[model samples]
Target chain A: MSRPALAVSALRPRTAPGWRTGLLDSLDAVGAVVLSPVELVGMAVVLLGRMAEFMLLAPFARDRFAFQRLIFARDLGDLLFGPALRVLAICVVLGIAVALVIEQFATGLLSQTGTANLVIVTSLQQIPPFVASGVLAARGALPLAVRLAEMVDRGQIDSMAIMGVDLVMLHAVPRALAVSLASVVHAVLAMVVFGVTTVLSLAGLGLVSTGTFLTALKLLPVYEKISLIGLQLLTASILVVAVALVEGIQGHGEERVDLARVSMVCILKAATVVLLVNLSFALSRMPDLPVLVWR
Target chain B: MRPAAPVDEAAANGLSVEVRGLVVRRGRRRVLDGVSLQLAAGAFLRITGPAGCGKSTLLQTLAGVLDADQGSIRLGGRPAATALAAGQVAAVFQRDSLLPELTVLENLLLPLIAGQHLSRRLAMLRAQVLLAQFGLVDIMHAWPARLSDALRRRALLARVMAVQPQLLLLDDILAGLDSAGRALIGRLLSPPDGRVASIIATSSRVDDFAHEAELLLTLPEGRISPSEPGQEGSGCDTRP
Candidate 1:
């Protein structure tokens, strides 16, 4: 099939000195996402392999020393402190704003007999994540895109390869994991911010009591709520990593190439992909997301 | 100068490289077609080819980074990929390929850290000695991005030596260096008292390697034929 051909093409032997064909070869696997199920599974396996490679390169692998873990923690801290802070703050702000507007306007017709409809209409578990993940991707992914693009623009990838180091393991793996962790962190931070904002804003306005507003959130479909949270994180990390890699690798040149220009494009493309994934997934999975989160 | 400490006896025994009917096809074009050659441990093989003759491919194949479409490559009777996976095979590309974010010392110590899992103290000690041997002590802490091309080149070669791979591959990295750089290439890439076997591919035309390279081969039209220093039959494809 075309997929096998693509995989073979990725393995094309001749590398003229100037061609950064390595990046193109990686793109081949990415292209296979559109292929048939068997090929798609194959592509998934490849992605998993790279993830494993990245994990092994991670400084915190089980075998590493305290020193290694300390260094790795510093890197994760840098990412968290830099771009991730914006993601968390933005998610919280969006959550609080949406909560304020929804609560203020929706005088739910909660006649004592309307409890079931209240459960369906007033579930805080579903829409907040969509908003939070979207905001997080928008506020996050760009800086990471720039950093990754610059790594490629420089010869860091080639250096890793020549060292017999797995490039994905060294670069991609930690990033995917860190950003995924950051996704959850954003979700939790949003929950806290929304909770606090709800108490302070409603108390200040003397509208609804904060205890009753929180009581409605208690009966969440626990499994679906957790799964949705995971799915959002997974999608966000994958989209950011994929777009960054594509943009970074496409620029297969050392001289006469503007790294800043390439990185700017990478940031734009990554943000676009992140938003598209958030929107498409939210839309396509809409039927199930609320049923699970609200039930 | 010798290795900082006594080299591992096992590490000192050089690796032999053997390729049989190696074929590497790129986009319906046979970049390397049915290539066959062999080199005994401690031997030197120099490949000179014009652009696009699969010089880098062949070196990469020996280094076990690139796959061979239809052939076999063995280092010391072990498969090339297996040897490479075990860190017994090493390569230096034409590009600096140093970790730009890392200091030269950290880059050189990486092989030990990644492969041998050497402790911090030992890895640092080994890296320093290797750097000193290569006359790179002064810039050991400099970022690779800040170093000059020639200086970075020396550091790259020294980094490979730090690995002490059985088979060390050079992909035309020795071109355009001043004499000091060339001498460093000779000292590090030559027999090294049988500590490593080296294959150098150069697109440049120069005499720096003439005296030291025991057997030279030229790649024209995807075929490997002997160059000067006559046939060191053991290092050539002497098939009928």
Candidate 2:
């Protein structure tokens, strides 16, 4: 007797041409790499828009905004105080290390004014925001992602949705705002610590007098200080938190392995976003990089 | 104290459910296939099947948590999603549904304040009353991690009940409870004043819900098996 057609087909080997398969794989990789940022940006826009709506409507819709206040307070307190000591330690160490390196390398190579200027600029305008982003990502964003992933895995998010709770309003907005506010606070703290440590180290090393350091600080324009704060705020509030919220909400899986993977991907993506944002800002400020700006 | 009336008292008074040719596929497997059922307002249904027989899937579908691949589900003459958005549907899953971060009292207050837009003072009052009703008054400030399995289940039910859902979908709520725990929760499930208009509960064993379920039917292989001629509360048609 002849074998059944189904069994015959099941026994048949299936293979795609090697060249075609390779081409398709390459295309898929390219598509993922190109489309991921676009998708992330779209989601971040929608999330931020919803948060703005809730905030703007709070006065007229106090009842609706009441529950979110509790969430905001809780998250804000956690984000601000949870990593305060770590951030402080990092800032103090970073400031002292940078100061010592500048004193050693630039003592005779550059004038005292130039060395002090470098110290002020690097401490206040650069480095601290990047370090703050790293700290917040590790301490704040990753944990937020893990917590949200757990909620997704456990079906608590679905349960909340079924109960008529807007997940964005209830969870995302508060967290994004908290992280943004906390990032600003941490960045400010870092800048202050770096300024203090650098000044103290330079004075102790005799590379620059306290008078010279104060003069360098006075030479730094008010606009520069404002711009630095603005840069930190924009990076943390928009980019870092957005990455965390998107990855946390969308990257959950049904297994513990999936949770770990999601956490890893969230941190990596957050770090990439922070770096790209700071790099863009740095490029825009460079006088030689006229191509980055349109007059 | 009596439970507070639902936000939409008119809609909550009665929520009739009609599900037709419902299909839910999980990957390659059809979890719910061509299942159909009709439930009148104020009725109780017990869906019994072996483990992995789509009981929870049906509940999730009915709660609007899962999308139906094919077919229709209507609650109170509206689509399931609409009814759910109106705060007319509540569900308790086999898994722990309580937010671990919130206290028992805060958990109860969540749906009220966030979902129903009730004032904090009113939500607090309603939450306290529900806690007292569920015998959870003593542990009102306790977190879900601190509660026993039975208490967690009770607290979950209490939180869902906070919104006074018109249709209650319960999946294996009595699974981990002892006999006394089961009995106490069973009494709570069928409140006297009829705050909940309808309930669809699922269990693996038929006898687990024998006392409270008004209609009992079996689901085998993603389809509802017809009730035997002499089965109790078999008046409702659940054939697929």
Best by TM-score: 2
* Cα lDDT tens digits for candidate 1, A1-295: 0000100102423455444676776676677544533542443355556666545655455433322343346545755555545645654565456546645564353323223223332334444455455554544445445555555444444444545554433454455556666666666665566556655564455545555555545544434557766786677665665555554444332232366776676566556656665666556545654563444
Q: Candidate 2 chain A, which ten residues in sequence have the lowest lDDT sum?
A: A3-12
Candidate 2, which segments miss by more than 4 Å at Cα? Answer: A1-32, A251-257, A288-295, B1-13, B192-195, B221-240
Q: Residue A216: error of model 2 in Å?
A: 0.8
Error of 2 at B10 (Å): 14
What is candidate 1's lDDT per residue for B176-208, written digit by digit as tens?
Answer: 777777766676666445445544445445455
For residues B134-171, what per-residue lDDT tens digits would candidate 2 score against the true structure? 99999999888998988998999899889888888888
Q: Give the DockQ of candidate 1.
A: 0.18
**What's the TM-score of each model vs. the native?**
0.66, 0.84
**Candidate 1 deviation (Cα RMSD):** 8.5
Candidate 2 Cα deviation (angstroms), residue A124: 1.9
